[model samples]
Target: MVGRGGVLRRTGGAVVLGTSLLGRLRRRDPGDAILRRAARLTLVASVVFFGCRYGAGSSTLATYGLFGTIAAGSFAQLPGPARRRARILVQSLPVVWALIAVGSLLAWSTWAAAGGMLVVGFVVAFAGVGNPRLVGLASAFQLFYILASFPPYQPGTLPERLGGVTLAVALLAAAEVFLWPDPVPVSYRQRLAEAADGIAAFLDATAGRLTDPHAAAVDRDTRRERAHDAVTAIELNRSPPASAPTAAGAQDRALRICAAALREVLAEADRLAADAPAEPIPDLAAARLLSSCADTTRAAGRSLSPGAPAVAAADLDGAVGRAEAAYPVGAGNARDAPDVPRLCRDATALALADQVRVFAVGCRVATGARLVGDDASSGLFEYARHSPWTLYWWQFRSHLAPRSAHLHSSLRLAVALAIARVAAGVLQLTHGFWVLLATLTVLRTSAADTRTALRPAVLGTIVGAVVSGGVMLLVDELIVYAIVLPVTMLLAFGVGRLLGPVWQQALFTVLLTVVFAQLGPEGWRLAEARLVDVLLGTVIGVLAGVAMWPRGAGHDLRYNAARYLAANADAVDQTVQAVLGAVPPPEGALDRVRRRMVLIDSSYCQYHSERHDPHRQQLNWDAVLSAGHHVLPGAESLLRRNPPGCLAGWPEAAALLRDSAGRLRSAYDTLAEEATHGGTAARPPVSTRCVDQLDRIRPLLGEADLESVRHLVEVDRWLAGLADSLTRISPPAADELVGHRRKP
Candidate 1:
C-alpha cells in the first residue's frame, strides 16, 4: 500500500485539478459554471442515495418511465405560468415512489405497467391544457414516446417499474428549482424593449434613404408591425394575475405607460409625414428626433425591474419631451416668437398628463390601494378575448405562418419516433432505441441532413457505449455508483457546451445509458441493437420531415424580401402624403415608418446568411437581394426627408418622385418574373427607366417643390445611377424579337 504521505499528495493533486477545471469553466461563462456545478452535485448526491436503496439493476424500468414522463410534461406545457405549475407538481409528487408502491401491491405484468404508464403519460401531456390547436399535437407525441418504450422487456411488476419513472421526474423537478431557476418571467416590458430596439436600429441604418417614396411606405409598414409585436407582448404579460409579484412586475407597469406614449408619438409622426407639401425636402431632423425617442424607450427596456421603475419612467418622459421639442412652429417674430413655442409645449404637457393618469390607474390596481377602470389599461381586452386556436390555424395569416411550420415539424417528428421504436424492437437493440432518439434530437438545420447529422449521432452513441462499457469494469457497486454520477454530470455539461443537438443528445443518452447499464446482460446486448434502431429512426424522421408540406430556407427568403418591400411601399405613401398635403404629420407616423425599415433589415440579414450557407439545397435569392440592397437604402433616405405626399413645391420634384416609384414597381415586377421563369432576361430596362424618370423630374429644379423634394429626388437619382451600373439584358435581343436578325 502507498504511504500516508503519498496518498495525501495524490489527494492534493486531484483538488488542484478539480479547481483548475472549474476555473476554466467559470471563465467560459459564469452562468454555465454555476449550472454545471449545481447539476453535477445534484446528480452525484441523488445517484449515491438511490444506488444505496435500489442497488445496481433494480430501477432501470423506473428511470425509463421517468424520462418519458418528464419529456411529455416539458413538451406539452405552454412555457409560461403553466410551466411553473408543472414544475411544482413534478417536484412535490414523488411520482416514481408512488407508481412503484402501487405496482408492487398490484403485481402487474410488464405490458400492464406499460399500459398504466400510457395513461399517466397522457394525463401529464394534457394537464392544464389550453390552446386546443396544440392539444392534439401534444397528445400524439405523448403516444409516440409511450409506444417507443413498449415491447422492449417487461419489468418484474409493471407498477414497480412505473414507480421508478415517477422517481426520475421528481429528480428532474428538484433539479429545475434548486438548480439555476429562470430569473425572469416573460413580460410586456421585455417585449416592448426588444421590439423598440429592433425598430430603432432599423431606422438609424436606413434613415438616409427615407426620402424615396416606396421606401418610405415600406418603413411605415415595418413600424406598424413593431407596434403590433410590442402590444402583443404587453397584452400577454397583463393576462390574469396582473398584480402578482414577479421579476418584471414593475417593468410591465412601466411598459404599459410607455406603450401609450409610443402610440401617441406614432400618430404625430404620421401626421408630419402625411401633411408636408410636395417640395424637395432635404433634412430629416424631425424623423431622426422621433427615432431617438424610440431609442430612449428601448434603452429604458434594458433596466426592467420593480425596484427601478424610474428607468422606464425617465424614458417615457424623454419621449414626451423630444416630441414637444421637435414639433414645428412659425419662425420667431418680434410680437409672437414665444407663442409658437407654446404650441409644442402644450402638446408635451398633454402627453405627460396622459401618462401620469394611466400610471396612477395601474398603480392603484398594483398596490391594492384602489381599482382602476378597465379602460385605463391598454391591450388588456385585446389579448384576453383573442382566440389562440383561430390564430394558430389561420393559414391565410402571414404572422401565423411560423406556428404552422412548428406544428408540422412536431407531428412529423412524433410519427418518425414511433416508427423508429417499433423498428428497434424488431432489430433487438433496446439501447439503440435511445441512440435513435439521440440522433433525432441532435439533428439540426431546416432540412434534415442525413450525412452531416449522422456522424454526430453515430459517434455519440459509440462513444457513450464505450464509456459505459469501461465504467462497468470498476464494479465495486458503491464505487461504480459514486464515480458514474459526477462523470455523467461532467460529460453532460461538456458535451452540451461543445456539441450541437446530436452530440448533446448523444452525451445525454450516454449518461442515461450508464445509469441503465447495470441491467442484466440482456440490456447490455441491447446496446448495439439501439444503434440500429437509431439509424432506422433517423431515416424515417428525415424522410417524414422532407416528404410532405416541407418548407426550405429559400422560399422564406424571397417571401420575407417581398413582404418587406411591400411594407416599404406603404411607408413611402404615408410620408409622401404628409409632404404633398401641406399638413403636419400625425403623431407616431415616424415610429410606424421606422418599424417597417426594421423588417427589411431582418429580411436582408436573413438573405445574406442564407446566400453563403453550405446547405445549398434551396434556391439562392441572394442575387436579387443584392440588387435590391443597391436600391432600398437610397429610397428610404429620400422618403425620410421629403415625407412623400407633403414635400414642398420645388421645380421637378413631383415628376421625379413619380418616376422613381415607377422604377421600383418595375424592378419588383422584373424580379417576380425572373423568379417565376428561372431567368433574368425578362427584367425591365431599369437604367433607361430610372434615367427617364430622373430627367422628367429634373425640370422642376427651379421650383420650391425642388427644395422640398430634395431628399426624395436625391434618393431617386442614386437608385437610377445604380440601376445604370447593372448590365441590362434585352429579351430576344430586340432584333430577334422583330424576326429580322434570326428565325424562330
Candidate 2:
C-alpha cells in the first residue's frame, strides 16, 4: 500500500510539472518558434523534392540541406535586417568559390587538397581578424571541406554540386528575409528590458549586503553576473545595422546611464560592507536609504518597458533629498578628539548618500528628462563611426604583427589542418575528411577554447550516432526518415540555445545519420563509422591545440589588462588637467575612457570563463575594474562642473593636482609594463603636497568653492586608492625579475 501510494504521488507530481512547463511555453512569444519551424520545413521539403525530381542521390540532398542549415543559422545570429542581408551576400561569394575550389583540388591530388585547405584556413583566420562575420566565413569554408569530402570525387559533378549549394543559400536567405522581417528589433527590446531588470535585482542584492556582512556570496555573485550580462547585451545592441531604424536614442542612453550608476552604487556598497564601523549607527538611516534607493531603481527599471509611463523627475529628486537629509553631518567633528567608530560611520553615511544622489540623477535621466542640474551627456552615443570595409582593412593591418591574436590563431589553425591531413592519410580512414572537419570545428584561438569545443564535439557525435542508429533500426521506411528530419533539426537548434554546444552537436549528428541512411542500405555501419571518425578528429584537434600556442586566452588577458590600466591612467591625467584649467578636456576623452572600461570588463569575463583558477585572479581583476568604474563618472562629473574663479589665486593647488595626476599615470604605466613584460617599473613616491595645498586653500574659499574643493579631494583620494591596488599586484618575485640576484 505504501509503495503504491508513493508511485501515485510521483505520477501526480510529474503531471503537474509537465503541465507547468507547457503553460510557460504556451505563454512565450511563439513568432520566433513558428518562423524557425517554417524555415526548417521549407528546407527539408525543398531538398527532398529537388533530390527526387533530379534523381541526384542522397549526397546531393544532404549537401543542399547542409548549406541551407548554415545560412539559416548565420542569419539568425545577425542583429538587424540590413546586416543579415549584407552578411548573406558577402559571405556567400567566398563560400561558394571555396567549396568549388576544395572539390576541384581533391579531384586533382591529395597533396593539392591539403595545401588548398591550409591556405583557406590561413585566409579565413586572417580576414576574420576583428570582424565576427569574417570568422564565420572562415568556419564555413572549413566546414565545406569536411562535408564535401564524403561524396565520391568526380570532376564532372563539381559544377552540379556547386549549383545545388547556391540554390540552398538563396532559398534560406529568402526565408530569412520574407518570413521574419523584423525579428532583431523585438529581440533587442526584450534583451534591453531584461538588462534593466538585472540591474535592478543587482541593486537590491547590494542593498541587502550593506547591512548583512554574512549575506550569501552566491546571491551576490549571481546578481553581479546578471548585471554584467545585461550590460553586454545593451552594448551589443548599440550599433544596429544602418538600414534598421534606431530605437529611441534617449531611452538607450538612459539604459546605459542606469547600468553605470548601478555599478557605482554597488562599488560604494562594497566599500561600506568592507569598512563598516565597529559600532552600528544608532538610527540605521543609511541602511534605510539603500533599501529605498533599491526600490526606486527597480521601479524605474520596470518603467523602461515599451509604452510604460516614464518616472517623474520630482519623485526621483525627493527620494534623493530624503537620503541626503538623513545623513548625520558634523557627527565626526563634534568631539574634541575624533571618536573612531563614529567618524567611520559618519563618513560611510555621507559617501553612501552621495552615491544615492548619483543613482537618483541617473533615474531622472532614464525618464527621458534633459539634464537640468549637471551637464547630462551620456557619452554612450558619441562613438567613432567607420565604414565596414574600412574597419575590415584597418583590423587586417593591425593584426599583421607576429604577436597579434589574429595572426597567432591563423597560424595555429593552418598548422592544425596540416597535421590532421597527414594523420588522416597515414591512417587511411575511408572518411578521412571527417578528421579535417573535426579539427576545423574544434580548434579555437586558445587552448581553453579548443578544450571547451572538443568535449562537446566528441560527446555530441557519439550521442547522435547512438540515438539515430536506434531510431533507424526501428523505423525502416523513407517516409519515417522524412518525418524525423524536421523534428531533429528543430530540437538541435532550439534546445542548443538553452543547453549550449552539446545538444546542438548531438542533434546535428542525428541529422547526418538520417541523411546518410537514405543514401545507402548500411545504416548501422554508417553510424558506427561516423562515431569513430568524430572521436579520432576530436582527439587530434585537442592535441594540436595544446602543442600550439599553449598560453591561449591567458596571454590575451594579461595584454588587454595592461592596455586597459594604461588607458585608465591616461584618462585620469586628462581629467585632472581639465579640472585644473590647464587644458580643455580633449573631445571624446570620457567616451574613450568608457570604451576602455568596456574592453577591460570583456577581457576579465573572458578570462574568468576559461579555466577555473584556484588563485582567484578574477577577484583581483574585479577590484581593479570596480575602482576604474568609480573613476569614469567622477571624471565626467568633474568635466561638467564649473571650477570657482578663486581657484586662479591658488596656483599651488592646481600645480599639486597636476603632479598627483602625473604620479598616478606613472604608477599605472609601471603596472601595465609588469602585466605585459613581467618587469616592474619604478613607482613614484606619494606626495603630501596635495594635502598641504588643500589645507591652505580651504579657509580662503567660499561655500561654493568649498564644495568644489571637496569634490576634487574625493577624486584625488580615489586616485590614491587605485594606485595602491595597482602597486600591490604589479611586482613579480625575484626569479621572475630580469635582474634578480640569487641568494648564495
Candidate 3:
C-alpha cells in the first residue's frame, strides 16, 4: 500500500508540472505567439529548402541565409514596424558588404589577409563606441570571418553568396511589416496612462510619508525613477511615422502636455515630503483630502485608455475645495506661534492643500477639460531633421578623439586579433577560425564582462561537443537529420532567449555543431577541434581585456557622472539668465538637459551591475548622483514659477540668483576636471547671498510671487548641499588654489 501511494504521488507531480507549462504558453497574447512562431518556422523552412536545392557544394549559401536572417531578427526587435524596416534595409547593407569584402580578400594571401583584418577589426571596434547600431554591425563583421572561413573561395560564387544574404534580409523585413505589427497609437496611450499612474502613486506615498517620518527612502527613489522612465518612453513615442494621420499627432501632443504637467506636480510633492515635520501631523481631514485627490488622479489615468470613462473636472474641483476648506490659507492668527507642534501641523496642512490644488489642475489638463484661466504651455515638441549620411559622419568625428571609448576599444581589438592570428598560424591549427570567433564573442567594453563570460563559454563548448557526438552516433539517415533539424533550431533559439550569457553561448555552440555535422562524416572530430579552439580563444580574450585598457563600466560611470553634473550646472545658469532677461532661453535647452539626466541614469545602472567595488568611490559617486537628482526638478520648478516678466520687480533677487548660478557652474567645472583627470582643484565656498536676498524680498511679494521665491530658495539650498558633497568626496590641495578667486 505504501509503494502504491509513492507511485501515485510521482504521477500527480508530473501532471501538475505539465499543466503549468501548457497554461503559460496559452496565456501569451495570440498575435505575439503566432508572429514569433511563424518567424522561426519561416527561417528554418528557408534554410532547409535552400540546402536541399543547392546540394552539398552550395551549403555555404544556405549558411549565409541563416546568418542574414538572424541579424535581421535582431534589428526587428526595435519598437515600431517602420523603424525595423528602415534599420534592416539601410543600416544592415553596408555591414553585409563590408564583411563579404574582407572575407573574400582573405582567400588571396595569408600575410595580406592578416594585416588587413587587424586594421579592419580596429576600425570597426572604434566605430562602435557610443553607438548601438555600430556595435551590432561590428559583431556581424566578426561573425562572417568565423563562419565563412572554410567555404570554397572561387570568385564565381561571390555573387551567389551576396544574393542569398540579400534575399534573407528582404524576407525578414517583409515578415516584420506584415506579422502583427506593433500598434503605435495603442502603445503610446498605454505608456501615457502608466506615467500618470506612477505620478498618482508617488503623491500618495508623499502624503503617507508626511504622516510617518520613518518611510523607506529606497522605495521613494524607485518610484521616482519609474515615473521618469515612463515620461521618457512617452517622449520617444511622440513622433509617429509619417503614414500616421494628423489626429495621431494631436493625440501625441496632448499626452505630452499631460506628462509634463504631472511631472511638475510630482516635483512639488517631493519638496513637501522632504520638508515634513519631525513630529507626526494629526490632521486627519487633510490626509483624507489628499487620499481623495490620489484616487481621482488614478481614475484619470485609467480613462486615458480607449473605451474608459473620462475623469470629470467637477470631481477634481470638489477634491481641491475640500482640501482647501480643511486647511485654509492663513487660518491661524497666533502672532509668533509659541506652540511648535501646532505650527508644524499647520505648515503640513498648508503644503498638502497646495499639492492637491496643483494635482487637480494637472488632472483636468490631462483629461482635456477646458481651462478657466491662461492655458499653460508645455513647450512645443521640436524634432531634429538630419540625413543618414550626415549623422554617420558626425558619429565618426565625435569618437575620433583619444579619450573616446570607441578609440580605446578599437585599438584593443586590433592588438587582440593580431595576436590571435599569429598564435593560430604558428600552431598550424586546422580550424583556426574558431579561435577568432571565440575572441570576438567574449571580449566587451569591460574587463569584468569579459571575465564573466569565460567560464560559460568554456563549459558551453564542452557540453555542445558531447551533445553533437551523441546525436551523430544515434542517427545516420539524411531524412532523420532533416526531421530533427527544425526541432533542434527551435530549442536552441528558445533557450538562448530565455537564459543568460552562459546558456546563450551553449546554445550557439550546439547550433554550430549541428551545422558542421551536415557538411561531412567526421562530425565528432570537428566538434572536439572546435572545443579546443574555443578554450584558447577565451584565454586570449580575457588576457587582452586585463592587459589592455583594463578600465570597465566603473570608469564609464565616473565620466558620465561628471558629464551629468556639467549639464545640470549649465541648465541652472541658462534658467537664471532667462528669468533675469540676460539672454533668451535656447530652444529645447531644458529638454536637452533632462534627456542627459536619463542617459546618466542608464549608465549608472550598467555600472551598478558590474562585479567590482571600491567602497569609498562607490559611496561618493552615489552621493553626488543623489544630490544631482534633487537639484534638477527644483531648478525646473523655479524656472516655471518665476518667468521673465514676473521677476522684473526683484532686481536684487535676480542678481543674487545669477551669482549663485555662476558659482555652481564654476564648482561643477572643477568637479568634472577632477573626475576626468584625477587632479583635484579647490572647492568654491557655499554662497549665502541668494538666501539673504530671498529673505529680504519675501515680505514685499504677493502670495503667488512669494511661492516662486520659496522655490528659488529651495534650489539655492540644494546647490549648497551639492557643493559640500563634492568637497567631502575630493578635497583640493592648498597649492592648486594659488590663482583661484576665493568666495567672500
lDDT of each: 0.41, 0.55, 0.55
Query: Could you tell me the lDDT of residue 318 within candidate 3?
Result: 66
Model 3 lDDT per residue over 1-744, tens place: 999999999999999998876565455433444337445544644564356334645665666677666555532333334445445455577667667766665745455556766877887665543343443355666555544433345556667667666766666556556655444435555676787788777767766766766777678668777766665454321323221111112232344335544544454455455555575665644455556656766777777665677565465456545644543233233332122222233333333333333333444444545445322222221211233355446546645654455556677777777677666666766777778778876775568667766777888788877777677777676666656666556655553434445655666677666666665666567778788888888888889989887776457656866787787677667766776677775345556555554434434333433444322223234344444443444444445544554555566667666777787788778777666655455555443233233454454344334334443443344454445445644432232111110000
Best by TM-score: 3
Instruction: Give the deviation of candidate 1 from the true structure as CA RMSD.
Output: 13.9
- lDDT string for model 1 (1-744, tens) is 579889999999999998987687667655563355335334633553355336644445535543444343333332333346346446434443444444343223344433444344434322212222232224324433443345434445555454545555555555555655544455544554565565444434333233343456576667656754554343221332222121112223233434443433333333233323233234433344444544554554454434544333344445445543443332123333222222222222222223333333333333322232342333211222234454223312322245233323334444454455445445555454353354354332235343345566667666666655555554436446545755665556453444344555466555665555544444444445555555565666566546633443334444554554444344444444445554454334434333332233223222222212232222233233333332333333334434555455543555555566566556555555454444454334443232344355445534332233334433454444334423232222221111000000
Residue 331 in candidate 2, Cα distance off native in Å: 26
TM-score of each: 0.52, 0.58, 0.59
RMSD of each: 13.9, 11.5, 11.6
Total clashing residue pairs per candidate? 120, 0, 0
Ranked candidates (TM-score, high to low): 3, 2, 1
Better of 1 and 3 by lDDT: 3
Question: Lowest summed lDDT over 10 consecutive residues: which window, candidate 2?
Answer: 735-744
Kindly provide the TM-score of model 2 when superposed on the true structure, using C-alpha atoms.
0.58
